[model samples]
Target: MRMALRALPLAFALAPLTAALTPIDALAQPNPAKMTFFITSAGLGNGADLGGLAGADQHCAMLAKAAGAGEHIWHAYLSTSATDGKPAVNARDRIGTGPWYNATGVMIAQSVAHLHDSTANTGKQTSLDEKGGMVNGRGDTPNTHDILTGSTPDGRAYPPGTDTTCNNWTSSGDGSARVGHHDRQGGGEFPTSWNAAHPSRGCSQDNLKASGGAALFYCFGIN
Candidate 1:
């Protein structure tokens, strides 16, 4: 009984140290490999007509949820052209303040400004989807590098009286939409611009495919 009683005190005394280390260990550990940025593995299948910003946002949320990232707010990185007296919406404004990371925990950007900089790291290999799969880029079979952005080089909506946004992302018809080269290499005007490579042939899915795209876009966590 005496030996048992003595051993109890030692166990009790060491308990506080163990308890203290628990929190320290947690603090020392890295953040969970949660996906905060990704390219859409697939689009809504209706060409550029993503049913407008709401529908596109919903699509992003749905895909993220399926990839186990439902807790974060997801937004499609697209711009809307001005028409009918409505002001244009910039793609940069929709997504939240940055510091976004991919599924592999690679930091893509620290802020919107950082993302727009010429030296940004959002390339084909880094801009993976929520499932951590690499979207096909230039030089790959079929060449799906043309990611739809609909925004200008500065990540803002095009000027009024223009139709570079596929009728504000509400048309699957004869309109054209701006596309980016996720691979950061192409023959278009902005070949080196990851999100502003050039424009697509048309807004149809078949057209997008013909122009080396799969109708995909980038999705970012806003929270």
Candidate 2:
């Protein structure tokens, strides 16, 4: 019943063009205890097959119901390519299929589009000859962006340079992608902090493309 990581090549390649910075809101907090339940449920439901984007959405809906917060939520899937051991491309393409919200349960700004695999790099073609240039593929992509900023749900900021990546719980532990809060050095409190900071952005997917594959779950508040 474990959650499976899905491959999202399109999301990764278009991330940079879609990534946008937005202001952090101080309200619409997340309930940590509820979030825990959401994560556990998602892990139990599809943590094994790597069902792809559909699995990620199903888990997000489950978390929203468990939290009883709102109908809107942002879900992201993480996966790696068979050729490159890094996160797959365009993981964020699924955003169009569901409701997207920020940490405070606030609808995310239109300008702030979601990136499928923030940790992974967008594959860009630099050469005129599509075949001649180094085609960005596999391990060549950079890591996804950290899920949480340095601050916690309660507004306590972490030391500068926190790991974020859902507290370094990436499917692959190569020090690249993390699963939940993004801040690695921080203590377990990160799960709670992340929930508090972003109730809507709850539920994250980490695909450990390496080591036979792995998946980690995070959730905030029930619907």
Candidate 3:
């Protein structure tokens, strides 16, 4: 049994390396192809003017395609207030029925109700980008923690009286857009609210940057 005894040592030596590469918990690692929810890695770069919901949805589809998850239809988690006699569009309705997971396979929420609940698992850790990378939070340099949502705490659009959507997400000049803190920790009236934290300072890129934002938002798969 000398040959068998000699091979045992090599097997033991390779075990740790394999384990390190493939992590003991497979569910905790990146699984882009199966991801259903993620924060946008980057914004449309035009501040809050996402070319309306159509352009924002297009961005989501483009990003999903690049992540290899294009089979599923994607939608930006954004809401629109009534403008030009059009009815408001709710963010919750756009994302479809829930139960979404991040790129790392971590469940962000079980349903639409759960997504707005305080216990949703969409904190700085689980609210990962499509690349399975964490977005900057409070203590990080430049602090890009703000995520544009334009909806209230319950994922519905605000009343048309005030400008909480950057003029229905078409202006980058003087209007403000409602933003949420993705990290769930910041200085806002609802600092811990993941979808309805505060309003942005302005719609331009520089104005958004002033309030610790980079024009980012969330995306969810509908199918």
- For each candidate, give its TM-score against the true structure: 0.84, 0.31, 0.90
Instruction: Provide the lDDT at 102 for model 3.
Output: 94
Off by over 4 Å in 1: 1-33
Give the candidate order by descending lDDT. Answer: 3, 1, 2
**lDDT values for all models:** 0.86, 0.30, 0.91
Candidate 2 residue-wise lDDT, 1-223, digit = tens: 2222233556665775555422222232443222211222224322233244355546556555545533545343432232224433333332343233333233321221321223211122210011112222223343221232212332232333433333322222222332333222222433322222232122223433221112433322212
Per-residue error (Å), model 3, residue 89: 0.8
lDDT of 3 by residue, 101-207 (tens): 99988888899999988889988988989888899989999898999999999999999899998987788899999999999999887999888899999999999
Q: Lowest lDDT 10-mer window, candidate 2?
A: 122-131
TM-score-best of 1 and 3: 3
lDDT of 1 by residue, 120-171 (tens): 7889878887787888987899888998899888899887766788898899
Q: Which candidate is the best by lDDT?
A: 3
lDDT of 3: 0.91
lDDT of 3 at 65: 85
